[model samples]
Target: MRRIIILLLLLVIALGSAGAVWAHGVKITYTVTFSPTIAIEAAYDTGEPMANAQVIVYAPDDPKTPWLTGECDDDGRFSFSPDPSKPGTWEIQVRQAGHGEWLKIPLDEEMMQSGQGVVTEGGDEGFSTAQIVLMSACVIWGFVGTALFFQSRRPPAQEPGEAA
Candidate 1:
């Protein structure tokens, strides 16, 4: 009985600790419009928008300091006009509720002037939604399977007065 109780407690603790990680899966993607402004959209792997999340832009010229900092709008979208004087890869970071994602966009003098809209992917290259869900389920099933295996190997609980 004590062993079973301990196993159950371990399972609960593991699941509780993993809950935060499972909740924080932010992905960021960007698109350059015809106006030279770069637009970004942040969302969870589950396709849910990261509403009102914090955004920080870092110019390539000054990588250490943030060029601009702001929060995403209600739709998880933010746009900023990059400094044409600084020609290189611009970095953007989006963070919210313990989840953060980074994106890098390379813009040279010619590329910025072209004004050709192109959708680009960025941020953590993670598994798809289905893959994530499947992996999580596998982990949970592992715990349950181990617990059941141990429980099965144990003999039935006997009353205190029963003979050995």
Candidate 2:
């Protein structure tokens, strides 16, 4: 019974860690045309496009509700013109499969006047150092706990010359 539980615990840990190694980071880039249109391009870090991904755009004035929602082209590209009345930071999010990223483009009055702005990516974008440390610690802790559990169930060693 004890052996069965220990094996199951180890199996669970193996399966958990296996899935963590199979992920690819997502990347997105954007360009604001002189026409005041924002074009977005989404792709995996491996260079494969996030073809036909879902897109949600939020205007500067209203951040909660989506200002506009659409889908990317086969090339993982989408574009839309911002509202001239709403001049602040425009947020665009692109998602496909299980990957997604947020792009924050601050379009203030000056940028609007110049017809362009510096686009930046935002959000807790990727795993932080703390997060990686915590995950490694958790896996090590599980292995240690499993070892302790396994060791506790071992029978005591007998002397070679002792009678049975």
Candidate 3:
């Protein structure tokens, strides 16, 4: 009887562990390499991407005069490296036929001195370890309790009824 109970407990633990492992769904990782540059994505108030829009960039030293001029791609995304010689705040003016916006891009002194790529990591957004453990323990306890209840309710061994 003791051995049977131990075996049952072991089986429950194994099944519970398997369930916990299966609950951890697929995991994906994304890495992006970034340089000291300004990236802008123009969009309308309705969340529509504004493509082929004129993008005029002005250096920090000379704000009134335009330094660089170009247009955004089809995805309304544009990127440009600031003038390292003039390390400060840059002014970017994005204009279309009817809509226009001004953006300020800042370049620190460290980035100007050492132009090194920076790596940013996006981790897996999933349940914490403690939560997973707690859930697994609850499932195992419930299964064990149910099994014990049914076992206790079984009819005991008895010969043919001779009296009430």
Query: Roughly what TM-score does model 1 have, to 2 decimal places?
Result: 0.63
TM-scores of all predicted structures: 0.63, 0.57, 0.49
The alpha-carbon deviation from the true structure for residue 76 of candidate 1, after best TM-score superposition, in angstroms, is: 1.0
**Tens digit of per-residue lDDT, candidate 3, span 1-164:** 46548977787677666633443132222232335566777765434556888889999899999999999888677777666788787777777885767766556566665766554334233456577667867987787788778767865434377456
Q: Root-mean-square deviation of each candidate, in angstroms?
A: 5.9, 7.2, 15.0
- Cα lDDT, model 3, residue 52: 89
Please name the candidate that would achieve the greatest TM-score relative to the true structure: 1
Collision count for each candidate, in order: 0, 0, 0
Q: Model 1 over residues 1-164: C-alpha lDDT tens digits? A: 58767877886787557544545578787877545788999988667889999999999989889999999998899999897767799999999988878899988877676755554445555676567656877987887788778867866675576786
Which structure is stronger by TM-score: 1 or 2? 1
User: Mind sharing the TM-score for model 3?
Assistant: 0.49
- For model 1, the run of ten residues with the poorest summed lDDT: 116-125
Model 2 TM-score is 0.57
